[model samples]
Target: MQTIKNLVKDNMRQYGMFIALLLIMLLFQILTSGILLKPLNLTNLILQNSYILVLAIGMIIVIITGHIDLSVGSIAAFVGAVSAIMIVNMHLPPFLAVILSLIIGALIGAWQGFWIAYMRIPAFIVTLAGMLLFRGLTMVVLKGQSIAPFPTSFQKISSGFIPDIFGTESIHLTTIIIGIILSFLLTFLEVRKRNQQTKNGLEVINNGLFFAKLIAMVTVILIFSYVLASYEGIPNILILLLALIIFYTFIMKKTVIGRHIYAVGGNEKAATLSGVKSKRVTFWVFVNMGVLSALSGLIFAARLNAATPKAGNLFELDAIAASFIGGASAYGGIGTVPGAIIGGLVMGVMNNGMSLLGLGIDWQQAIKGLVLLLAVGFDIYNKNKSS
Candidate 1:
């Protein structure tokens, strides 16, 4: 029993943010008279937060590299403008326009990378300059007008739902089935990982604690899935998010490039000496950030069905706040993809909840600022204690 308690305690530190998210959601659920988690609102929440999540994912990588990109929001706007010009003005196919937009984003990233990684300019200065540059360009491209009523196909990118395989008129059978499968797969993976660790003579969580975790995770997955199924079913944006999460999580946890990234962030001189290709890692990180920013722009434009110069205003703040709140160390060398996701969700929920309560935008911004400060303070406290 004591061993299980110890296991739980240890895991709690690692999962503290997730716990906070659940508690926050629960509080809002009750305060909002259960409107917070209603199927339709839940769906809206996912859609509303999807672009921020994409940016957060990319921002986490940049932060982990001991660097920051101040221009993601601007880049998103620029990319969205380019997309609008391509699809709406030039009459390009939506798919082709998306491809061109992504390419442009990669090019923009590479341009920044050359300056920051190759020329050795400070990332802060480089990205700050980029923010202004891109913002101006977005304005020029948009020409002080918003382009709207995108092609139906492009709009569907963000607004579409997955086809129900079971074709049920009521509950989405496919979503429920997917939920069950995911639950089992998650449990199996956890158990397998623990077993492998044990085989390698590494410490493992107590069996009781492990089982409890499995149950909790499975329950959450099932419940969330049910909620989606009860609505219009799983969204296309959610699927994109899941794919990115899984892909990045694997890259960070299992790949050589991932290790090099952390090593570079931890100590650039040492990583270089160890043949970690610090410059290359830094360059690629920015490139990845660029691509993500572009993707977010596409998603945002699709959702709004418009390309506005103001499309991605202050988005960098949301992404940066999310990354930091999710456990990314300001000084780098510490963070997780999952942490970033939770952090973004925390911000999203706060915004949604505040709006629901009739709180003004001024209060929302102030509250978010305070939350960001507190989160960074907690991180610093932890770092100090550990050191």
Candidate 2:
């Protein structure tokens, strides 16, 4: 009993938002008369918010390094417009366009990073300037018109699905098989992690709690897979998102650069004294953000099948909200990739749920604002309590 209490207490910040997410889902599930969890609705939810989630992933890293990027939405819009011009006007191949767009995004990141890192410009001011500059550039590139009819191959990046090898009707056997494999893999990883901790004489969670966690995770994965399988199977974008989440999670948790990011965010002076290259780290982090912002723009444009001047408007707000809601600290140096993903889901679910309930867009925006305020407030409260 004490162990369980301690576990919850220690991980309250990490688990609090997750539990809130479940409760929110449950509330909407009842309010929407069970439409909230329908397979089709669930699938649409993932598709609709995919871009914002991508931005959230990048945003969390930036926040962890004690910075913000207010220009991501504009960057996304600008990149989308540029890609449309390449693919639609110049008749470039979709794959080539994507590669060039990502490179362009990286260069934009480098531009802003230079000012913020080397020139000592505040990120807020520099990115604010970037926001205006890029939004204007997007409009100029599109000539105030939306570009449409993206190639079928490019559209598939957002709209396609993985084909089932098993070829079973009425259910997606491939999704289920993937789910089972994932469950087994997760179990193996958890056990291996526990073993490593034990070998190193580190304290391990109680066996009962650990097993319970594993069972719960596996069950959730299976049920989620079943839900998606009942519909049109997993979307291609979901696979992309999963890969990104896994990669970023590993990077943040395992890599030396990841440690350096945290160290720098926690204390730049201390980190610099400890041999970390704070400027270079900050520069690279912004560059990475630019690339992600570009990827987000591409995803949004692909999903819409058009590049509009307004495409990605207010996206920076959504990404920032997700990072904070996911448990990233305002003061920097505290967050996780998984936490940011959960935060994005929370926002997505709320948006979907409110729409289903026939709530007005005005109310949705207001509610989301309140939620963001509360989430950040909670973080500050926790920080104060801990201190």
Candidate 3:
């Protein structure tokens, strides 16, 4: 009993967030007369929020390192514009255009990193300049017009679904199978990790609580899979998102570089004294952010089937909000990729639910602002209380 109590105490924030998400979903689900979680709506929710989720993934890393990237939205817009020029005007291959766009994003990262890492400019000012600069460049490139009709292959990056292999006319069998496999695999990994911890004489969860958690996870995945199967097979972007989540979670929790990033974010001078190349870590983080931002740009453009000068407007805010709502510390050194994803989903669900209720844009904006404020306030309260 004591072990379970201690475990729950230690994980209060996570549990709280989980419950809050469920409550919000339930509230909206009721308000929308069950429209919020309908099969089609769920699929739309994923598509609508995919870009924000990608940006949140990168933005959390930036915040983790005690920095911010105001230019992500503009960078995404700029990259999308470039992709349009390459594929539409130059008639370049869609594949080549994507590769070049990502490379261009990396170059942009290097440009900003040189100032931030080596020249020691404040990140806020640097990225603020970047935001204006990229937005201007996007306008110049697009000439205040939208470019459209991208190649079909490129469109699949955002709008396609996995081909159903089982040929089940009524349901997507492949999606269900994949979900079951994932649930089992995740449970096995958790149990194995617990055994490893015990072997190393580290604290381990009580077996009963551990199994309970596993059961909860399995149930959620099965339900989610069912929802997707009822609509269409798993979306291509969903697979991309899952892969990114798994990869980043591993990097942040298990890798040397990940530790260094956290250390730098925690205390730059102390991390430097410990031989962690703080500058290098910061540089690579921005580079990673650039790549992700570019990827988001491509995905957004694909989904819209066009590149517009106004594309990605206010995207950075969504990503930042997601990071903070997901429990990223303003002071850095604390956040998780999965948490950011959940935060993005929360925002997405709210947007979808409110739209279904026919709320005005003004109301939506105001409500979102309040939600962001409360989320940050809650985090600050928890920090102070813990201290």
Candidate 4:
């Protein structure tokens, strides 16, 4: 019993997320008459949640730095508008348009970063103003209208699946193969890393902990891969999104800069005293958010095959909800990439399930509101308990 307690304490963050995900799934499965676990519905859940996941990652970083970005949704709309204009109206090459739009996103981030970091303005006010400003700007750019029927190639960024050149029909063997290889490779690397830690005289976790984690990961991957492989091939956007998740997870886990960012979020004065460049870190965080907002915009436009003035309505709420639901603190200084991902999935699943049941949108939103309140309440409780 003591060993089990110690094991849980040692990896509480990981286990907490895993347990939360399972609990949520179970709750929804029971509520939705088990349709929540159906393979088709699960696939839909992933696709729907993909965008919020993108924004949640950015929002988590922003929140980690003790900052809020109310403008992400507006930025997403603006970026989507810009991408549509560049590709469809201006007749630019799709790939080049994408690249340029990403730069524009970076520039947007730089714009907000400058005001917040160098100007010493409150992030809330800046981002709030930006939220409104960008929404209006998006309208102007889109001429108070919606632009649709973007090129097929561009549309595929969000709506298309990986090509299945090697498949006979109905299944993409390549995707399954990729999933299997990826699963084993990831497992192998984890084992190798732990073995290295043991050799270095580091405090290696008990073998039980390692096995528990591995079993959890393999189960998740196999289930996810099986669902996707059974669908219309793996969604390209999901693949790209997963790659970004892995890359950012590594950045947060393995990089000093990532640590500094979190420290700044945890305690600005302490981090500054410790020789950390809090300003630069905050600036980069916003800049990174901008870039993601841009990518999200392009993907949104592509997915709808239309650029609407309301492209990212309420996206800020979704992103914030994802972060907190994933275990971020309202006061900042905690949260993980995987946590944000799970949070996104949680919201995604709820929305998908509610919609499938033909529940009134009002009820769907009411439930989400209750969930958000509960999540924030949990954070406060945890924070006070720790204090």
Highest-TM-score candidate: 2
**For model 2, where is the 10-residue window of minimal lDDT?**
1-10
Query: Can you write out model 3's per-residue Cα lDDT over 1-387, one digit (the tens) per residue?
Result: 888788778886666567778888999999999999888999989999999999999999999999999999999999999999999889999999999999999989888888899899999999999999999999998999999889999999999999899999899999999999999898889989899999999998877778888998999999999999999979999999999999998899999999999999999999999999999999999999899999999999999999999999999999999998888988899888988998888899889989999999999999999999998898888889989
lDDT per residue (tens digit) for residues 281-319 in model 2: 999999999999999999999999999999999999999
Q: Rate the local accuracy (lDDT) of all candidates.
A: 0.93, 0.95, 0.93, 0.87
lDDT of 4 by residue, 34-72 (tens): 888776777667667777789998999999989999999
Taking the tens digit of each residue's C-alpha lDDT, what string does model 1 give over 1-387?
Answer: 777677666664358889999999998888888899999999999999999999999999999999999999999999999999999999999999999999999999999999999999999999999999999999998899998879999998899999998899889999999999999899889988999999999988777767888999999999999999999999999999999999999999899999988898889999999988899999999999999999999999999999999989999999999999998999988788989999999999999988888899999999999999999998898779879
Clashing pairs in 3: none
Q: What ordering of candidates by TM-score runs from best to worst?
A: 2, 1, 3, 4
Q: Which residue pairs in candidate 1 collide?
A: none
Highest lDDT: which candidate? 2
TM-score of each: 0.98, 0.99, 0.97, 0.95
Model 4: lowest-lDDT 10 consecutive positions: 9-18
Task: Select the stronger candidate by lDDT from 3 and 4.
Answer: 3
